[model samples]
Target: MAGILIIAHAPLATALRECIAHIYGGCPARIGALDVLPDSDPVEVVAQATAEIERLREDNGALVLTDMFGATPSNIAARLATVPQVRVLAGVNLPMLVRAVCYRTTSLDMLVEKALAGASKGIQAIGPGTPAPEYGCSPTPCAEAAADAAEQAAAGATDNVKAASGLSAGVLKPAGAT
Candidate 1:
């Protein structure tokens, strides 16, 4: 019965809400988004998000996630943090949003931690040598091959002097060239 509030810049809030709905299935009644309405003032947006937070708290405590620290949305969330049953986390990412939706019923403190952890885990590198392939096949060579092809193409198209000097075509200054 608890809620998760998402506050982001204009236009982004709606997209994020849809993404949350897609990932978590059927939008949550308690969930709220700021900046969706036309010409919405920051204070009004905060109040609206806060209203939802209060509602959720009456039902069960709520967790609020904002897109950036010290931004309007996060500032409002910070104000709400003083409330006894509310918790706020800034720098919200897709992973944190999804985790919050999935664990909406969790304790406020635990949900905050889980959302932070989800955000952190979502940023990990997905390149080769990162356990991406079961057989441990390296992807470095593939990247190097692409780079080599690009270099070869550049070398073939440019003058030898430019190539020798490590400068792209049309990049040399007459005064600087010997």
Candidate 2:
């Protein structure tokens, strides 16, 4: 099993773990985190993250997830990647973390793919005719529709919320646009 090491800005990694606990009842073994504060020492964080990764890795490889590409957490993760059998992925999110936990028993490469898929699919924008949040509407913001909306916007076209109006008519529609 590949160990999960979440390295992120202060409190984010911890909060993500807590969220997982809240949803699943308990934290799984081989999953850990390193919270990098704004004023923390970069070199020290590197050393600490490396040691933590080693501890979590145990007999298996480790999968590290950082908040963003060029931030402190990611920089430390980059350093940790020098360790053998370690993988680092940026854009740590709730969906990605949950998915990583579920698939942590797989190979590091496969875990990375699963985590990315979860993160990408987890993001969504509001659509019209979607039930109000109180009504329990499921949202699925299709990327192609969003891109098309952007193109329309750049072309000075007005967006009408009718794109997703079919939800109330038993005609399921893609999110963001028709």
Query: By lDDT, who's the top model here?
Result: 2
Off by over 4 Å in 1: 36-40, 133-178
Q: What is the lDDT of candidate 2?
A: 0.72
Lowest summed lDDT across 10 adjacent residues in model 1 is found at: 169-178
**lDDT scores of the candidates, listed in order:** 0.62, 0.72
Kindly list the per-residue Cα lDDT of model 1 for residues 49-86, writing each as its tens digit.
76777766634577877887987767777888887777
What are the per-model numbers of colliding residue pairs?
0, 0
Give lDDT for model 1: 0.62
Cα lDDT for residue 112, model 2? 84
**TM-score attained by model 2:** 0.71
Q: 44-126, model 2: which lDDT tens digit per residue?
A: 99999988887889444899999999988999999988889898999999878876765554457766887898899778775
